[model samples]
Target: MFKLITELKWSPDGCRVETIPKGEHEDLPERAVEIAIQLSILDQSTGGPNTGQQPEQPEQPEQPEQPEQPEQPEQPEQPEQPEQPEQPEQPEQPEQPSKKVKK
Candidate 1:
């Protein structure tokens, strides 16, 4: 069996052009297909037989979105404490009446 190979490159006009053996044309990279799509070089008839579908891309497993980190519950704002009342001033005692009359 002969081993076939090809090299791909972007043409100045943005086509997915390739270098291959005289009669071999099938087989290309998905990256090539993507570039070609952007450059308008690919359509329904272009990549299917040559590039195929890239082995279905392996599905990427979805990653579950990291569960959103549970939002941390916002840490619940601390309630403000009530102000303490100032202590009342003590009343001064009245001076005792003049000493009882002298004996």
Candidate 2:
């Protein structure tokens, strides 16, 4: 893959100049990239691939199977707790009169 060092003004057919941005030109033709490299417009890329896809990872080793755990014995049902008695209501207090503040 070739990486563009600067903006490329290329005219493949001598008709019009196509402005290519400064970046990887993996989508472009290899020959065009080579010409760009010769003109100091591009450089070789250090990426894995230009296919726009991720590389496949190596297969992982299978792990050893774990032994089956023994079933736990069923627990006995707990006895229900008796309901507690309700508390007596407290007597209501009388409201105090508000004092007038002096300016």
What digit string (tens of lDDT, one per residue) describes model 1 on residues 17-80?
5542422345545555455444444444433654444543433434666555555555768777
How does each model score on lDDT?
Answer: 0.47, 0.64
- TM-score of the candidate numbered 1? 0.26
Cα error of candidate 2 at position 66, Å: 84
Per lDDT, the best of the predicted structures is 2
Best by TM-score: 2
Model 1 worst lDDT window (10 residues): 1-10
- For model 2, residues 1-103, the per-residue Cα lDDT tens digits are 5577887777677697788888765576544554565676755444524334432443344699999999999999987765985578888877776787878
